[model samples]
Target: MRLIQQLIHQAVPDLNGRTFERRSARGIIVDGTKILLIYTERYNDYSFPGGGVAENEDLIVGLHRELAEETGASRTKVLQEFGYIDEYRPHHKPEYDLIHMESYFYVCEVDCDFENVQPEDYEIANGSYPVWIDIAEAIQHNRKVMANQEPSMGFSIARETIVLELVERELLGKASAV
Candidate 1:
């Protein structure tokens, strides 16, 4: 899959410190004009349904597995490669650590028959749940979250906001016309 986007943050990190790199795979699952999103109460924002790709796991397979784990989608069809984003920032709280992350994205559609998603304890405690919302609404809300500037979700929400707009302008545009 070709890289569609690259994002960089200007925050300078400690010259001599630990650098953490995390690679994640996220999904843009849609049905009609509605899109699936993960809502994190801790940040009071929304995000795409995905997480870190396991070592040695193929991108597509990891995404499929993540969808099943995060949204409990019984089945999913990989529609297209959406894009990719590279994020850079100083680690929250731990100032000496610089966090660099690569997020791979894809468009997908989930078939019905979902079970309870198996989420970690933190997710359950934080009220992180999946919800379907209009692409426009998703874009609006994500932008709001970004605008509010919550430290935890600010950067991530900004990236998701971009994806939402693109999916709305491109994918939803075509789907509506059809």
Candidate 2:
């Protein structure tokens, strides 16, 4: 992990001494009209199954690994990169400087049965379950989760923006057709 961090610093010389900067990656796993979501035990909110990128790993590779680890969805093809979300949280204490992270979004196809899927060990440690819900239903449920339940659901910029980006692209495609 330390080696990867060093590599990242070498690759992106602009980053400061923030080796363990708070980082995350989310996999937008689409299966027909339904998308895969993970119901987290800790937060009791649902989001797409994916997690943080390793120290030196490429974003795409980390995304693939995360998706597979979370949803057992090994066969996935990344379709498009939807923008990114840059946010920060307090480091050790509220008085400290914020730890910044930029989460990249990718739309992808996966072939897995949501019901039978098992989250990998790390996901089990996080207490998450793979679930497939209709896109519209998932969005509405996520809104509720964000508003009333888990804060992560609503606070996840990557999840929110990725969905919006995909919807916007779809709408644009439709408009161009007419």
Candidate 3:
């Protein structure tokens, strides 16, 4: 997959010390101007419908699992790779100094009818739920959350916003002509 961007959180200390590496996969499912996303009420922001890949698990398999778990999506067919985002941030776990995350994104298609949605416990506590929202609206909402520095905002908002813009430009053909 291509590298879309690398982001270092402002709080990350400038050190090349111990780090924990994590790999995640996210899906981009679009229908006209709307996109399938996970809306976390606590954060008041949206994210892709996927999560961390388990050890030695195939990226696509993990993506499918995450899709089903988070959004009850089925019959998902991956169209193509949509690049990735590399991010570095302070780790919440004391075992690591920082966390280096590589998030892989793929363009995909899924059944319109969702069922049996079963998000992880933490996700449920966070009030995360699947939603189909306009791409521009999601982008604008995320940008606002970021601008206001919302206390409940999750770490993925910036990455999600950037990816949403890329989707708008490349997939939706909504980019401004220069």
- The runs of at least 3 residues in candidate 3 whose Cα sits more than 4 Å from the true structure, single-residue gaps closed, are 176-178
> Could you say which candidate leads in lDDT?
3
Over the stretch 1-178, how does candidate 3's per-residue lDDT look in tens digits? Answer: 8999999999987748789888999999999999999999989999999999987999999999998888887678999999999999989988889989999999999874556788889998989999999999889889889999999988889999999999999999997222
Candidate 2 lands at a TM-score of: 0.66
Of the two candidates 2 and 3, the one with more favorable TM-score, higher being better, is 3
The C-alpha lDDT values of all candidates are 0.77, 0.59, 0.90
- Candidate 2 accuracy as lDDT: 0.59
Clashing residue pairs in candidate 3, if any? none
- Candidate 1's displacement at residue 56, Å, is 2.0
For residues 50-161, what per-residue lDDT tens digits would candidate 1 score against the true structure?
8888768888888888888889988888888878887776777664377778889898888633465888787888888888887777777767666677666655776777
- TM per candidate comes to 0.84, 0.66, 0.95
Model 2 per-residue lDDT tens digits across residues 1-178 = 1111111211243544443465566677665666677776666556766778877888888887777777777587888775556554434554534455667767788765555465668667767788777666655555556556454443453355345435434633321111
Kindly indicate the candidate among 1 and 3 with the higher TM-score.
Answer: 3
* Position 16, candidate 1: lDDT: 42
Sort by TM-score, best first.
3, 1, 2
**lDDT against true structure, model 1:** 0.77
Off by over 4 Å in 1: 13-17, 92-96, 112-114, 150-154, 174-178
Q: Deviation in angstroms for 89 in model 3?
A: 0.6
Output the lDDT of residue 156, model 2: 52
